[model samples]
Target chain A: MSGREAILGNIRKGLKRSGPLAGTALELCQTRLREHRPNLIPARAQLPHAGQVELFVQMAQEASATVARVTERAAVPAEVARYLADIGFAAEAIVAPDASIAGLDWSAAGVATEARHARNGDRATVAPAFAGIAETGTLMLLAGPQSPTTLNFLPDAHIVVLDAARIVGPYEDAWAMLRSERGEGWMPRVVNWITGPSRSADIEQKLQMGAHGPIRLHIVLIGD
Target chain B: MQITSPRFKQNAHEALGDAALQRALGNLKAGFPGKRAAAVARMPEFEQLRDAARDLKNHILEHLDFYLETFEANVKRRGGHVHWARDAEEARAIVLDICRKAGAKTVTKGKSMITEEIGLNDHLAANGIEPIETDLGEYIIQLRGEHPSHIIAPAIHVNLDQVSDAFHAHHGKYGKTERQTEPRALMNEAREILRDKFIAADVGITGANFCIAETGTTVIVTNEGNGDLTQTLPRVHVAVTSIEKVVPTLEDATLLHRLLSRSATGQEIEVYGTWSSGPRRPEDPDGPAEYHVVLLDNGRSNMLGNEFREMLRCIRCSACMNHCPVYGAIGGHAYGWVYPGPMGSVLTPAFIGVEQAGNLPNASTFCGRCESVCPVRIPLPKLMRHWRAREFEKHLTPQGFRFGLGVWAWLARRPKLYRLATQVATRVLKPLGGKTNRIGSLPLAGGWTAWRDLPAPQGRTFFEQWKDRQQAGGAK
Candidate 1:
């Protein structure tokens, strides 16, 4: 027998099942998978939209990411430029091909942005987050044509633009939003839940930032 | 990779005496458990979350076949391949075949205990494929040609100066001959060296923290982002995990993730939680072109229905080890296997054999700290006792122990004889107490009293004292 068959056979024997579940067990398993019921949502995540965004900003900062709030979508370019100037960086960045970012006039804000994935020498990548999670101050980025996964990594600095409206209370809510947007059965190739800049404590348990990914993660929040 | 578990007593004795290992083990108390306590204090519902996590795993284990089949189907739907391996050799063969098909000259690896369990690096190197460990700790241990001492912190046994020497010896050709004394500088040097390996590698292999059956996604949580670079930069990406890692949905995975990082490092979440479902898309600028998953079940299938079934609920959090007093004393190397601490004590016997690993279960103090801190509530102490019971039943325990326990059990069955025996023993040993009221040494108990004195029996046995108090009409 194949390895798959033998392994599955052992599992069946271990479970003491003569065959697959016939009625309730099978039905319950299918229903649970389809429903995807979340267990024990933290009370901290049960906040209003404004409160959630506030919590997200607070948590993101606590995780060592810089957060800047802008009033509108058009203001994102200027905010990115300001953050770069404040951090003593160049005006150039590798921007994601997402239409939301592509349509923005970055050059108008005195920033030279190219629409592509990050390369070895890329200093920064400007991308749009699918959602911002308030519970842990995390940014949810889905991989696709608009938001290449490489843009999340493979760069010295990562500049993300998250709309305040897109912020959710926790990871479960983020999953629900994805189901609603992409349909229940569909999933992106990659789902990145980035809390902050990369770090390592392998040496003497001393934390040093920017291990392999971005050294600085500056979030440009597109709302009050 | 080798089972040196039968020599556990000797290994532990040596580990306790090793100056360098003792110094490294000193950091365990100051590091792991405190952060976990603080993180748990903030979340009021953390206990409830643990229950939820435990139940979900139990649900999946009962219907593992169905979930595995569903996971395979989803991966196929997303244009990925899933290979099932009944044991270690088959798992190694499947991974080697993938590397050969990819024509991989060099493979970059993320930190994976499963890889350590299967001895993947040696296997790949024997087949003329260079495997580079990208994680900083794993890299250090790999350089020293040693197995991981700790699951999460592979090089926890190595000190800074040792890391410096290892790097200096190997990095001479890279124009980095100067020894880096500072941790920051050492980390930067590793980053610089591993950067080239990541870009040049033909294949990447990582272990999945969870395999979501709903979307066919493999999730990896890492603070260093090495796992990310390993999976993303290579032409082919392969995830090697055990069969028990499969979960039903992303929601379930998220709850477990909430507990894992906090318990492991006291962080609310890891720096990066990357989930890869398949290979890169057509319009994607960069990512692996091919994706594969190798699911290995060396002995987990047999553990499913047995007394050790709860062991499968382990998330590799290291909370059990961090809180383990024995682990704190001996460090991970003394456990003499891939896993250590309370979890290892129970699991080692299952993976290896009771005869070879009986010493591990016997090594515990039954402090119950590991089970209390366990997010899944594994009842690790109870499991260890189960192993001890099995060992005794199979006559794996030493003859001396059997004789001693048999004598005690035979005496304890008759209450009157037990009282008489204890009273006589107390009377005989009272004079030996001396001014210190402690026994410095005793026959058959030299092992226990070698380090410290055992307290002598005070005035009388409890039975005699109780009878005297009753005669004096003491308070009931």
Candidate 2:
């Protein structure tokens, strides 16, 4: 028998389920996974939409991320340019090829943009987030052809364009949104829930930013 | 990797004497607990969340076989492979096979306790494959050829000067020989050095914090994002986790995630909570081309059918150890294994035989602080007591202790005899105590007296006080 069979057999013997798993037991297991009910969401996460957006911005700042608000999608490039200049960075960055972000005119905003996966030497990366979670100020990015996962981690600065309308309260809501959009029982190769810029407290338990991922996380919230 | 748990006393003695380790340990004592306390005080529903997390884990462990099968099938559906290993040797061999198939000369590693448990690095090095540890703490320990003193903070036992010296000694060949004392400078130096390794590595290995059975997703929580970089840059990705790490659904992972960060660190959420389901998809622009997960059983299967089964509920928050007085005194290395502190004390005896690690369970004072702060409420003190009971039953405890307990038990059977024994001892001790009202030293109590004087028992026994209260009530 394979190692899988042996380990499973050991588990069965130990748990005292001597026979093959009966249909009822299997059904209960499947039902639990299928229903996937969330338990005890914090009261703070159950706020109204406006309250959520406010909390998202507040919590994001508390997590050490800078936030900018744009009244329209057309203003994203300008906001991006302003942020780059504010940080004294060159007006150039790699952007994800998501359709939501693909139509923006980078040159019109006076910023040079490369639409591809993030390269190791890339200093800044701009991608469109799948959703923004308000409960903890986390940005949810799914990995696929549209938004490569490397853009979230490889660059020193991560700039995300999140549609303010897509912001949700709890992580469960984000997962629910994921299922509704991508279909149940399906996910991309990866889903990154980035709360803030990378940090490390490994040395003497001192907080240091830019340990391995982006040092700065800048989010541009675009209103509907 | 060798079990020095049998020599816990000797290890703790050495650890206590090391001035550098003592200084580092002082920071650990002051660091994690207060942060956790503050985080808990901020969240009103934190206790409710702990209960929810514990119940979910208990439900999952009961149906783990079914969940594992479902997780395996889902992984296969996503074009990933799941390998099961009954023991550490098999697990190590499985990982090596993957590396060999990819013709990997070098592998970058995220911080993984499972890899350390299975001795994966040494095994890979023995097979001529160099493993680069990318996590800053793990990297420092790697340079010094030492094991992690603390699980989360691998270099928790090493002071800053030691880190600077290690970097200076090792990074000289990279043409950077300057000695830096600031933590930020050290972090930057390590980042610069590991950045090249991340790009050059052919394979990346990480440990899963939780595996979602519903989606075949492996979750890794890291503040440094080394795990993300390690898995993202390499062509092949492997997640080595034990069978117990699997949870039934994303909701379960969410609930545990809420409790884990608060208990482990003060963060409401860690910086990077990345979920990788499989290899890079067909339409994915970047990610590993191959993904594998090795599910290790070792002795966890045995732990499932017994009293110690609740240990599997651990989310590895390190809250228990952070609150443990014994751990704060001796640090992690003194426990002498891959794991340390209260959780390790209970688990070490289970993994290695009780005979080898019996001393670990005895090291506790049963303060219950570990259980109080445990995110999943694992009842750590109760489990340690179980180990102590088993040791006593098997005659593994010292004969003197057994005889002492036996004498106490004999006297306790008769209430009159017990009361007389205690009353006579109290009277004899009062005169000995004198004006200081403390015992300087006594036979068979050197352990307590050596540290400090014991306060004299000047008052009447509880039975006498209770009787007097009853008579006074009757008079009233």
Candidate 3:
């Protein structure tokens, strides 16, 4: 027998099922998979939209990411430039190829941009988040042509822009939105939920930031 | 990877006397447990979530075959390969076979306990492939040619000066001759050195916290972004995880994800939680060209049917170890395997034989703190007792221990005789108590009195005191 069948056979024997589930058991399994219902949503995640954005900012800041609110999409370039200047960095960043980011006139705000995946020694990468989660102040970025996975991890500074309208109160809401956008059972190659800059406490249990990812995480919130 | 668990008592005895390990363990006791307590305090629904997490795993275990099959089919749909290994040897062969097919020269690895369980790196190196551990903790231990002492913190046994010595000795090739004592400077050195390997490695291997059956996705939660780079930067990505890691859906994976980091390191969430479905899509700019999942079932399938079935619910959170008083005292190396602490005590006996690891379950104090802090509520103490029973039945325990147990059982059988003996003993030993009412040492119980003074017994036994109180018409 194949290794797959042999292992499954042992599992079946262990669970006391001679074979696969049938009738009600099979139906119940299928229904549960299809439904994909969440177990229990934390009450802290059940907030209004404005409240969620507020909580998102608060939590993101707590996780050591700097948050800046911009009134409109056109204001993102200026905000990015300002953050770079404040950090004493160059005003050039590797921007994601996402249309929302590509269409922005970065030079108008005195910032130079290379719209592609990040490479070694890249100082920063500005990308658009699919959604901002309020519960943990996390940014959900799906991998695709517009959003390259490398742009998130290969740079020292990660500058993310998320529309306030795209913020959700819980992770389940973000996942549900993804299922609805890309049909059920269809998942992106990668779904990244980034809470803050990378960190590790491996050295004497003392945490140090920028452990193989962005040292500074700058979130440009595109609304009040 | 050798089962030194047979010498657990000796190893623990030596660990208690090692000053460097003691200092490191001192830092560990103050780190993770306090953070977990604070994290739990903030989340009012944390207990409910743990119950839900445990039930979710139980449901999956009952329907393990269906969920695993579904997971495989989903991975195939996403253009990824799923390989099953019945044991450690097969798991190693399967991984090496994939590396050979990929023509891999050097492989960069994310921290994976399963690979350590299968001894994958040694297998790959024997076949002329270099495996680089990317996690800071795993990397330090790897440099010392050591296995992980702790699951989450692999180098928890190594101190700062030791890291400095290792780096100073090995980093000359990379033009770093001076020893870096500061954690930040040392971390940056590793980052620079590993950056080249991540960019150049042919295959990247990682462990999965959860394998979602609904979408055929494998989720890896890491505070360091190294797991992401390990999977994304290589030409081939292989996720090595066990059979029990498969969950029914992403929602279920998220529910457990909420509990894992909080329990492991007291973070609300790990900095990076990445879900990889398959290889990169044609439209993607950068990611692995091929994706694979190596699913192993070394002894966990057997655990599903036995009294230790609850052990499969473990998320490798390290909470059980951090809160374990025994683990705090001796550190992880005393357990002498890939795993340690309460979870390791139960798992080591099952992974190896009860005979080889008979001393592990005996190492516990039955403090019940591990189970109390366990997010999945594994009943670790009960499982250890089960192992102790099996050891006694198999005659694996020492002759002296068995004889002592027999005499104690005989004495316990007769209540009157037990009371009489205890009263006589207390009266005989009463004068030995000094001004402090504590015995400095005793002839037969030297082992107990070696480290600290033993509290002296009062003149009367509890039975006599209870009878006197009853005669005087006590409140009870």
| lDDT of each candidate versus the true structure | 0.91, 0.91, 0.93
**Candidate 3: where is the Cα deviation over 4 Å?**
B466-476
lDDT of 3: 0.93
Give lDDT for model 1. Answer: 0.91
lDDT of 3 by residue, A1-224 (tens): 98888898888899898898788999999999999998899999999899999999999999999999989999999999999999989999999998899889998999999989989889989999999999999999999989998999999899999999999998999999998998877788999999999999998999999999888899999985
Worst 10 residues of 1 chain B by lDDT: B467-476
Comparison by lDDT, 1 against 3, better one: 3
DockQ for candidate 2 = 0.85
TM-score ranking from best to worst?
2, 3, 1
TM-score of each: 0.97, 0.98, 0.98
Q: Residue by residue across B313-423, what tens digits does model 2's lDDT show? A: 998889898889999989999998888999999899888878999999999889899999999989998999999999998999898899999999999998899999999
Per-residue lDDT for A17-68 in model 2, tens only?
A: 9855678888888888899988899998999999999999999999999999
lDDT of 3 by residue, B290-341 (tens): 9999999999999998888999999899999999999999988899887899
Worst 10 residues of 3 chain B by lDDT: B467-476
